[model samples]
Target: MYVCICNAVKEKDFRGAARRCSGGDAEQVYATMGKVPQCGQCLEDAEDILFEERQLCTRLPAANACQGLRGLAPA
Candidate 1:
């Protein structure tokens, strides 16, 4: 799905940027891609995608750590 038409940014690309973004900021995502939000129409959707991706990124590391710990537990 095209999240930012102005910059030709797709959802997948945005998700990658979201994961790479330390602050999980929408603007930073755009900046990382060497693009900028124009017309301001895609801001909301971009932000929404960024938020969802950021949430997933944050949880994934912890989920993986938990899985690793599960193997270490006393059996």
Candidate 2:
């Protein structure tokens, strides 16, 4: 489940980061976790996984809210 093997970041780590990005900025998650992207290969998978997780969580708002500028607000 680790998203970035080089950095030792897990899928849950990415999930937590994505959740924190309620502000609609993945950079916030990256910064908070102090993770540096090594190879760019993980980026797409990380995002896709995060998206799927969010979709599965009914507690979260509709996915669209987290799509554009709307995601800048609270989740």
Which candidate has the top score in TM-score? 1
By summed lDDT, which 10 consecutive residues of candidate 1 come out lowest? 66-75
Show where candidate 1 strays beyond 4 Å.
Answer: 62-75
Error of 1 at 52 (Å): 0.5
lDDT of 1 at 20: 62
TM-score of each: 0.74, 0.60
Per-residue CA lDDT of candidate 2, range 5-70, in tens? 878888877776675554433445566688767876777777676656555543555654343323
lDDT top scorer: 1
Cα-based lDDT for every prediction: 0.66, 0.60
